[model samples]
Target: MGGLEEWKVLGGEGDQAFPCLEKLSIQWCGKLKSIQVLFPALKELTLSGMGGLEEWIVAGGEGDQVFPCLEKLSIERCGKLKSILICGLSSLVEFGIEKCDELRYLSGEFHGFTSLQLLRIQDCEKLESIPSVQHCTTLVELNIRSCRELITIHGDFRELRSSLKKLVIGNCRLGALPSGLQCCTSLEELWIVSWGELIHINDLQELSSLRRLSINGCDKLISIDWLGLRQLRYLVKLTIMWCRSLSYFPEEDCMGSLTQLRELDIGGFSKELEAFPAGLVNSFQHPNLSGSLESLWIYGWDKLKSIPHQLQHLTALKGGGATIASDLESIGNEIAKKCGGLPLLAKVLGGTLHGKQAQEWHLILNSRLWDTEDGNKALRVLRLSFDYLSSPTLKKCFAYCSIFPKDFRIEREELIQLWMAE
Candidate 1:
């Protein structure tokens, strides 16, 4: 349908056309201005690069249903589309619109979509507001980003609090977070990034169910309510980066209270902040942190000269600060070659050997796994690395990971809970 100027009615004047068509995609139809066809059985419809489309008119009549079974609809790069009027999409479960430059407002209420789970809108510079989701009880994920004119999200979150699991808001023009966000207690993952006007992050104490929280690229953010963070006791992974104006650090006593935190990542601070947070760096042996912290990653600290010496006390750390002897360079290279140029294996081996002695590195380089002819070199080396785990529980955890498919992004807290249940 590329370069098509118009799509005529399918079949005949009163015929039920394409009643069984399940999927249809129209791409680069630059001259198409309107689509009035009926797809009674369509489950997915995609329209992309529709350069001249100005309208999608719905056939209005008694008992007429268009796209009655559509579960997913995606529209992208339709630069001239000003409005979307087609209705009867109550079955839409996932709706995404991106790069529709001329779209300003969605026309109807989305609460009719009882089965809707994911809605994503991005890169629509003219879009000011989206339809309310106040009654969309089954909505599981909402992602809105790069809509420069969108100043606020409209709707209460009480209906979404029970089902919404992931929420991502980024690169928008809102000066503050939406007022209803505090009510989404069921949200498990939240990311706020690339926002320029937000100066403070307050009122998140009620998100007790949050497991992963990331705040990045908010240039003007100066402080977070640490009291609120202390209340999110279920949070396991936290990342804060590229927030050059943020100067506040949690108090020393606060780290000891976050008993469930496992991973912490902080970096890209301004140079005026000469050192890492004393609470995190100076007090690594805090009882809770020593027992719970498993991974710590810090980078882009241009002014800091060395890592904290006390970090060695964290026995649970799989990868944090490690000092390799200058003498181990050749042995390290040999071990790296045995990794078969696989970066994942290299990363795993490095994390496994973090804070180990020089003799340990040599022992790996000379292990019989390298001499075994029965398996791939990388697999043999990976097995050898797995055998080096000092804790039986840690080894069991690693073995349990084999149940997941390769490259699966397993959630850390969920894995911990599963291990506990085991």
Candidate 2:
């Protein structure tokens, strides 16, 4: 049963043909054309990488049967499979399909699935659309990603919205957002990414219960309508990244109204900007806004020169006798400490002697020495550490680690095995 790679073994042909198997996996069996596996107690089944498999049918005692006790099923990377005909699976809850390019249809009828809860489809490039679920009332979560040919989603999504709390779609050519998604009052998180032609953000106005929202890599996006987001009073985190055409942040008092907003990350905006807005940093320090605001990351601003002076109040290091000017210097000093020593500050101090020494240690400990000009300086520090290891046994043990690939984690067991083999 373990290593019989190529032998046609029928289910009822043998006297005792694995009737107690609750889980079965058939992998890399190149000549397997058909499977009539009938395990009455089977709850989970997985078929993967079997190249010659063209069809599969599960039969009942004598006629068409239903897997009344099956809970999970997975089909992956089988190129010849064209469709999965569900005869009867009354207890199935979760189903997953991946990388099967030739699969064009999921099943003959969608109403057969009465208890399915989660359906995930990924990387099946030839799949055009999902089968409509007319009878699946208990379904909750649906995730579709990287199916390039899938352009449309049909059927009433609102029917599942009452129980479906999470929905994610990414890397598909979907051109418009589905309507009536706002009725899902129980939805907490929503995410959309890499839909090339998506230009509208107005469809997000209906999500009143959404606490977290993220949109990234949608190149054609132009603006965000803050008026539509007024109902999202409980929103905590908002992130918008890699939107090339986004020129402006919401007007000063726009995001200030979200009293519950805690974190904001607006990075990779490909436009040139001179500086942040005047009252922008001050808003983070406002009494109502200050209590919830914790982290802010703004990157990819090519023309950004410095942080605003008011940002000093937002740092945790500000305390008694520490004026704004002094606190600013303290923050800069902390960053310099983390960098070992500031190259800019070292140049102003007349030379980089101390800076060079600090940089060398930083490179050696972090193991980033050989990847840049600073690596040569890091190598000098690493050699110094090696010089102290004069013991032959310790030196040989450390030298053996060099055989591993760069950035590899050298486990204690692997080192012991290498030594034993030697």
Candidate 3:
């Protein structure tokens, strides 16, 4: 029900509305001010685009339960919502709030939710702090992003050390990472992005179970403790990009220990970076990393004159190669000439041409798509790659990814299911 600006209350005193309703969604009702109903069996509730809603009041005596079995609650774009007086939601497994620009505080009793597992808060411009979830022992995923005014996340990390697996915090104003973050020994995936005040990141050696780590767009980051990174023996993926001030690259000795690393992406250095780090080039030749690597992406090194010859030795790369056959060398050089040394375009073309037949390389070299301006070459290359995909389902899956927000991480099983649904 949308555009219901005259509604002030959903239920009166002593009223029991939808006693057996298991799911409810109220969207875009701008002036529907309050929800006073008792939904005893509600398992999911969504209030979205409620522009005039200021409060959600639980109507009952002090000890009476309103929604005893509610498992998921989502509130989005409720611009004026300020308070939610709710309790007895001990079974809530997921809670998400987004784009509530005027919300500064949550009046709900979140501490008693013992089964809570996922919590996400985003785009709440006025929210300064999150309520403490220290008592939620089962919480596994916490994601907070784009809350410009958010200052602190109130929680006791010691209590979440064992259960929390994934944590993403970005686009906020915190001067430093949350205290006690290193204590989450079970953390598997961590992303730190767009933070401006953080200068040094240390203490990551404590997260022994980490599998993927990404640090991007941190304009002020200067150095990372590579010695600590060497301790992550199980790390599979690592990405460091757009951190212009970061000058230190891990030594070859430090990279030797990452035996399980499958993907490495490091680029976007400052103009002051006169040359690519010698240590990184040598690290690529290390038997441990070279044999295990499957994907490699390196760009933004404008000063580098040539691609590393050591990259040719990474035999484990999936359908990727740097050297062409003797017959196709001239065609390969022609393709390179067309790319004009743009690092990003070169990387894309390399992926597309590698492991393809000789005729396919000629097709790409002779295509009219190359007649476009230099700036549009990347798009043409992407279009060519998309056309080459043999599986229609794979094409649909690739296109479906654009529906999500940038930097959003979706699990493999979930993404496959979404593709199937589509």
Note each model's CA RMSD in angstroms.
10.5, 10.9, 7.9
Q: Which portions of model 3 show Cα errors greater than 4 Å?
A: 1-15, 56-64, 82-88, 107-109, 250-252, 302-307, 322-422
Cα error, candidate 1, residue 121 (Å): 1.7
What is the Cα-based TM-score of model 2?
0.66
Question: Which ten contiguous residues of candidate 1 have the minimum total lDDT?
Answer: 320-329
Q: How much is the lDDT of residue 110 in candidate 2?
A: 52
Q: lDDT rank, highest first?
A: 3, 1, 2
Winner on lDDT between 1 and 2 is: 1
| Model 1 C-alpha lDDT per residue in residues 43-73, reported as the tens digit of each score | 9888888899765555543112666788999
lDDT of each: 0.77, 0.63, 0.77
Q: Which stretches of candidate 2 lie over 4 Å from their true place?
A: 1-19, 54-64, 80-88, 101-109, 133-135, 248-252, 270-286, 302-422
Instruction: Using TM-score as the measure, name the better of candidate 2 and candidate 3.
Output: 3
> What value does the lDDT take at residue 21 in candidate 3?
90
Whole-model lDDT, model 3: 0.77
Top-lDDT candidate index: 3
Supply candidate 1's per-residue lDDT for 52: 93
Quote each prediction's TM-score. 0.71, 0.66, 0.74
